[model samples]
Target: MKQNIGRCEFSQFPNLSKTICQEDDISNYVQHLNDLSSDFETRFEDVLTMVIPQLIINPYGDIEETDVILQAELIGISTN
Candidate 1:
């Protein structure tokens, strides 16, 4: 999330910052947030692809959808 924010094109947000928030700019801001959220979702899915295979290969493999989700959360937290 930090990296996504860092990669934002600040020039596109001329009136937005810590000190100022323009009501007119609200739509643009929302669009940016939506795009960033989509990007992060795609990245997380990629992370799952890399992690799920290994989980399935475990000696006592008993992986479920919920297990994949939990593992993905741990992997995301650990990397950050």
Candidate 2:
């Protein structure tokens, strides 16, 4: 599993402040799994499923509550 954790800034999305703070809890959970001899890939996949949906997609999609809306993730733009 890749240990390279990327950086993310939540200053622009204050609603995500608590979500960002939850990363520490995720890290500790993963560490606990590791100590139990869990595979890195398994741990990463588990954490990703829990964190990504709850923190990024769900919260951002609730437009009535948050302003930081994520439409899509793309590498480049094109027209056909």
Best-performing candidate as measured by TM-score = 1
Worst 10 residues of 2 by lDDT: 71-80
Candidate 1 minimal-lDDT segment of 10 residues: 1-10
Candidate 2: clashing pairs of residues: none
Which residue pairs in candidate 1 have backbone atoms (N, alpha carbon, C) closer than 3 angstroms, thus clashing?
Answer: none
Candidate 1's residue-wise lDDT over 1-80, tens digit each? 33333444355445534444454565566678788888988989877666556544662333343366576665565467
Best candidate (score: lDDT)? 1
How do the predictions measure up, each by TM-score? 0.32, 0.22
- Cα lDDT for residue 27, candidate 2: 71
Kindly list the per-residue Cα lDDT of model 2 for residues 1-80, writing each as its tens digit: 21322233445556754465456765775577566555656668766566454435553343344332432321111111
Model 1, CA-based lDDT: 0.56
